[model samples]
Target: MTDTFKHRGLRQKLVETVKAKGIQSEPVLKALGKIPRHLFMDSGFLDHAYQDKAFPIAADQTISQPYTVAFQTELLEIKKGDKVLEIGTGSGYQTAVLCELGARVYSIERQQELFKKTSKFLPKLGYRAKKLIFGDGYKGLPEEAPFDSIIVTAGAPFVPKALLKQLKIGGRIVIPVGDDVQTMTLIIRKGQKEFEKHDYGEFRFVPLLEDKN
Candidate 1:
């Protein structure tokens, strides 16, 4: 709960590190700078919180690397007040970043432990998502369809069609698609049945699980 001046200085260095890695989105960098990433982790890992790397969290999931979060968020190109859906609400770090950017976020978490913990924790920090569901990320949130953008925080073997269909026309999804290693993929909906796909380079992430809750 304590974010001291030292923590803020470390976070600024982290923003610089991520920026050096080619994350140029001002909004993304600003949001990263604002969020207290160390507060999202277990106290034991506090010393490593500001490094530009992912670290283990509860349920064996990793809070995504700062650079990866920035890269994916920047690709989504979120506008203020845009409705965004986030899959795999791990430590709620990414959700906080999305909130910091002013997106109306609806996030799903398959891990009940994380879901319950984060459901309570995020609001305490004033990063309130529109909805946080303890459900399968693979299914997406169809009840709240037509999101302006969707971001999958874990690696998927392939893009989930349900997610693709959930986007508003011209909306985009930033997902990492693959197995052990993932290729960061961006798919933009062009029309009722048309999508434009682009693949960025590879990165590793926890697998996006399905139906285990």
Candidate 2:
């Protein structure tokens, strides 16, 4: 429960590192710098927490690398107060980043342990989502449909139709789609039945499991 000057300094370095890697969104970088990433992991990994790397957390899931998080977030083009659906809560690091940008996040996690852990832990760190649900992310949250943006933090074999259907027209979705390796993908909803897809390159991520509650 400690965020010190040392941590902040290390985080600044991490932000610089991500900036060198082409994550130019100032808001995203500010969020990266503000969140105490070390606090999201077990204390045992504190030394590696701000190293721009992804580390495993509870339930066999890995927190995304800082660059990846920034990349996805930058793609969403989030605006303040936008309703955003996050498809994997993992360590809640990305959730905090979204909150930092003033987005109203509705996050879902397939792993029950992670959902319980992150849902409770985020508030202690001064971050909170609009809703945190333990459910299959593939299904999205139908009742809360039409998000201004949606982000999938894990590797999906394919884009789920439900997620696309849940976006507000002109909204964007940033995701990594594939199995062993994923291509960072962005889909912008142009109209009622039109979407524009773009790929930003490759990344590796844990599989996004489906149909599990």
Candidate 3:
């Protein structure tokens, strides 16, 4: 692969865009800068891969818009070597970002084609995960219980109870919650019985569903 990101214009734009929008986390910006988004998208989309808008990938799914990805990633407040569980892997773009932030990622994708295909792309992007599961993400990764952070890519009716259970104390979960016109929410598990929820703002996303394929 070429060093396409070195001295790239998009990286500069990402820095400016996130900064203008109040994305305060430096590591999140660094990951956005370093990741070559063009590689993850269809060749036809190479021209717009680095833009802030979401674009279609395989299986009728779109890569998360760069701003949304940055917003959610920053909400996690991650440090080095955190264990993150990602529900709704989609194009694996957000999964790659979490991995870049020094998280041991375990990503679950509901679409069989997306899971099968992105399973290979992860390595190509230079990120390793505990596993990429082809399953209903609503259930989460039970075998790998207790994630330091959990991020859900799709919009759900509410934070899944199982997911809240899996978050270790002080762990943060960023999710999109609603049936229509979802709001991006951050859920912090403070203890075995207490959790705090914060809503960032309205967002439109494909609804989170329960199915393996």
- Among all candidates shown, the one with the greatest TM-score: 1
* Superposed model 2: Cα runs more than 4 Å off: none
Where does model 3 exceed 4 Å of error? 1-7
Q: RMSD, model 3, all Cα superposed?
A: 1.4
Q: For model 2, how does the per-residue alpha-carbon lDDT over 62-118 read when each residue is reduced to its tens digit?
A: 999999999999999999999999999999999999999999999999998898999
Q: Model 2: clashing residue pairs?
A: none
Return the candidate ranking by TM-score, descending.
Answer: 1, 2, 3
As a TM-score, model 1 comes out at: 0.99
TM-score of each: 0.99, 0.98, 0.95
- Candidate 3: which pairs clash? none
Pick the lDDT winner: 1
What root-mean-square deviation over C-alphas does model 1 reach?
A: 0.6
* Cα RMSD, each candidate: 0.6, 0.7, 1.4
Q: Compose the digit string of candidate 1's lDDT tens values, residues 1-213.
A: 999999999999999999999999999999999999999999999999999989999999999999999999999999999999999999999999999999999999999999999999999999999999999888899999999999999999999999999999999999999999999999999999999999999999999998975
